[model samples]
Target: MPAIVHFEVRIDPERRDEAAKYLAETLAATRAWPGNQGIEALVDDADPCHILVVETWATTQDHDDYAAWRTTPEGKSSLGEILAAPPSKQVYSETLPLGL
Candidate 1:
């Protein structure tokens, strides 16, 4: 079954725009990664400095591999410096489905 991952990124208010731009630039490569189902970046309306990155993957292992890759030199280089704090990540599995 697929899994959902959420990354809560907090940036300095002054650098929010730059962070958003970096996210946009990096998303293409992320989406192209194997096992990635989808990815999205959303900025909080009440708190512009907070950006939420939602990602769906084929499995937990897939997400873990991608995360490990992101820490490598190549991945680190692609990510520009625009963060106030380290991103917080959480993983979830769909236990119950509500018909919409």
Candidate 2:
């Protein structure tokens, strides 16, 4: 079954534009990574600096592997430069689409 992962982060208000560019450049690797189905980044309406990243993967294991890699020195991303607070994440599995 496919898995859905939500990654939410609060960006520095002064670096909103930079965050856009940074996420684009960084997430490109994720998009190309094995087992990645798709990914999207969205900004909050009430808070311009708040961003949510939605990612789809082939399975929970696939997402876990990708996430584990991000913690490594080689896979580390530069999110610290733009973030105002630590990021939060949620995982969902066993999806059942209802043709919405």
lDDT of 2 by residue, 17-100 (tens): 899789998899899889999999998999989999999999999999999999999999997889999999999997578999
Residue ranges of candidate 1 with Cα displaced over 4 Å? 77-80, 94-100
lDDT by residue for model 1 (19-53), tens: 75788788877898899999998889998888899
Q: In candidate 2, residue 91 scores what lDDT?
A: 94
Q: Which stretches of candidate 2 lie over 4 Å from their true place?
A: 95-100
| lDDT measured at residue 54 in model 1 versus the true structure, 0 to 100 | 96
Tell me the whole-model lDDT of each prediction, alpha carbons only: 0.83, 0.92
